[model samples]
Target: MAAAPRGASAADFETAATHAIILDHRSGRVLFRKNPDEPIPTASMSKIMTVYMLLEQLKAGTLTEDDTFVVSEKAWKKGGSKMFVEVGKQVRVGDLLRGIIVQSGNDASIVVAEGLAGSEEAFAERMNEKAQELGLDNTTLRNATGWPDPEHRMSVRDLARLASLTISNFPDYYGLYAEKKFTYHDIEQSNRNPVLYSFDGADGLKTGHTEEAGYGLVAAAERDGQRLIFVLAGMESARERATESVRFMQWAFRTFRNFKLFADGEEVETAEVWLGEKVRVPLVTAEPLALTLSPDMREQMRVEVVYDGPIPAPVKAGEPLAELVVTIPGVETVRQPLLAGSDVARLGPMGRIAAAVGHMIWSAE
Candidate 1:
């Protein structure tokens, strides 16, 4: 392992938000976390789940972008941010999505809920079911609009996981979050997520604010081929939320990186074989191996193969034979399975006798 750098270790990093988390999108590695699992009022951030439900329908072919839903008086009368949709008027699903994502419209969420599940209460039930299905154990949805309610809560980690699911499962629709503004009924509203405007490479996600939840954001960005998903909640103000989101995201990108150690099926080492037609069997990784670590840690990184013996008569190709162990300072050691690259047939009876005699003679030297 290399000497620890002097400036700032990942352990020393901190954030002001009451609940926060950062995750490596590709590997699902948690880069940073603070009170990540405690469910708290999520405000409009819960709308991410609302949008997710809509996206699922779209992906399943049950709904289309051209689909329209009537905006009920209930939706029109609901308070808070809105898409300024007219009551009793039919609105397109595409526009409603824009309304909810870019405008953070509580009304748009209600419209989606009613359009899909007939009522907000039913839609919330579906959301809870889906939450469990998706392994968001700490999330609970009370309403489609994420309207202030004591029961509407989600943890920062759950929010980040939801963000990851949305981006990976609905790439086509996820881009809508990057839109700077949305216009409906001649009313224009800029996206509430400030990171899109202030941070480079930031594309999509949701932001939230309420008296109880304070201010929060679910943000993601892609630089190079790697993407990061992060959540920040309970900030004092929107300005602080914006500042801290960008700052924490920048720190995360600057501190850690994904390093590809080996490609899929690439030979890692060779293991000796006893009484086999072939003297050695090639060892390879079944999948590409990558690790997230600080750039400076590369110099101290160590990789080695571990296997029990150089024995066995017949070996099947792709059979698990050894382990690839990786060690880096300040990071947990990673272990990957190494498999036999090709089949090694057992030696013939005569060949085994000759091989044993040769081995004995070679050992005498």
Candidate 2:
């Protein structure tokens, strides 16, 4: 998916951020992108991953909200944002999550890291391993928090991917990002995510800032039945981060609409079979198919099923046999595989001979 105006062939949307990407959550389509793959300093936005590690444990039943982790001297002494956790005091898993999400507490991040892996270094190792497993090719974790480290980098696209995973895979824990404030030891700090406060449907994600990374945000929102996730980095200030993020989300939701072309296993075309028990086999989509398109492009969309004619016999159900190509004016062409919808048994020896003769005769005619 791509963004374009009503009659333009190229994207017209622009942003002030150094790197960015907007994604349609349901269809997994990229609506807009600019330098999305470049690895750069992530700042505290990396706490989303730190919190994600904890969420995994909670969802898997390995850790409960009541479970406590003793805060270390290092956690208490760490600078930047603070949850005001006391040194040597055991903190609940739930409060630490709020600290990390709502307060952007570096101390809380470290507490979770140390409690889960015995040390920040070990926890970062697990983060790296999990990044690989999640197919985030441009991310590297050097510490538990998104502190200013030279090697602690993540691409805007990777951050969007991580945001998507966090929302879809851990819905129960993802709500923490929407929390407005969290108080610990009489100290209260508001969540750093700007969209949560400004946007209509906005909820989760995280924010980041450093002299090197500037300001960044991973914002998500849902309106009506659609959801979008976007990432931004290298803005000059918090105000710009907030303005651009909300504007981008509004632009994305306002412009593009996701259109469902076919449901899973829905037949799109029928292809002739060669010497099979059946004369033809239905071609169907293996997964639900949807695309994000501007309203203008939607009217001009064209679909085609391309395949070799008279496919060989003994076709098994779900075998890839064709391609469904969708073309929309002013947007990139999309192609997806089409599968055989049902089994088509090969004809017996005599039946094959007779069918071949019939095919030959039909060809002559």
Candidate 3:
């Protein structure tokens, strides 16, 4: 008989942000969530999409780092977090990218949008189209600069997803996020992402702020090969956003531990095999199974093998014959395949008959 594992109490961590999400980058797991799906003004975090679109162009060979784009009057005259790009001057694609990422420059974002799509409105339309294709259901783009608009909003979940994609898909360009400062037209500004300066494994991402959105950040960090991407919105101040983000990241890494529960070819259980020379077959996993859990939750973790009884006839080595289900409180259940560890040949005729007779006697008893 198979039994489900015991459940443990959920984590007690709390945060001040109204909307946030923490995701495991490698496994696509949601480590923590709070109103993640609710749409909110993303402020400058929406610039990530603008950057993503430009990276796509770079990858497609339509643009290059050395290529220069002419800054328009609209970009030079734009407000908030200026890259200070002068009108009628051609800036390298690489520098503009750094400006947007390191400086959170609205002007640089608008320049990229206009350079590619010919106008901010047209580029924003493309942004919406790309958002749909990326499965960002709660994301809508009104402009490249993330200027406040009732129509421009993204869910924290979507922001986290975008950050993940940007890091994973555009490794060559992702380094710009870690750059502390960028200089353009004799003006320099520091990267606004709080995690970059204080967090050990922190790298590039974006920060956003507006009267409407308050202060927000899309942040990523990696430690010991594990990466976490998180999004926070509706923070009351820059200090609050910085403090809460670091605390949340610390909790995620410190509280949970990833343990290797099963190694490849490690026998997990013995399953009955009918009409076979061997009465039972060893069941094992073909690959290692690693799970993340808190210490208390690990103590209560359950592992169950589910399969039909008396697997009939010959069983081949490495044949998938059972399921290994792991349950832990406050986390999604993990299912892994259990495979036959060795071959089990069918029983000879006499042996089969004797086994049948023994089975009948056992049934009668």
Candidates' lDDT values, in order?
0.87, 0.88, 0.86
Question: Could you say which candidate leads in TM-score?
Answer: 1
* lDDT by residue (tens digit), candidate 1, 65-151: 899999999999999998888899999999999999999999999999999999999999999999999999998899997788889
Per-residue C-alpha lDDT of model 2 across residues 123-154, encoded as one tens digit per residue? 99999999999999999999988999889999
The sequence of per-residue lDDT tens digits that candidate 3 reaches over residues 157-256 is 8998899899889998888889998887788788888899888999968999999999999999888766778888899999999999999888878866
Worst 10 residues of 2 by lDDT: 1-10
Count clashing pairs, candidate 3: 1
Clashes per model (N, Cα, C within 3 A): 0, 0, 1
The pairs that clash in candidate 1 are none
**lDDT score for residue 87 of model 2:** 96
List per-candidate RMSD values in Å: 3.5, 3.3, 3.7
TM-score for all models, in order of appearance: 0.92, 0.89, 0.88
Best-to-worst order by lDDT is 2, 1, 3
Rate residue 96 of model 2 by lDDT. 94
Q: Relative to the unseen true structure, what is the C-alpha lDDT of residue 323 in candidate 1, on a scale of 0 to 100?
A: 95
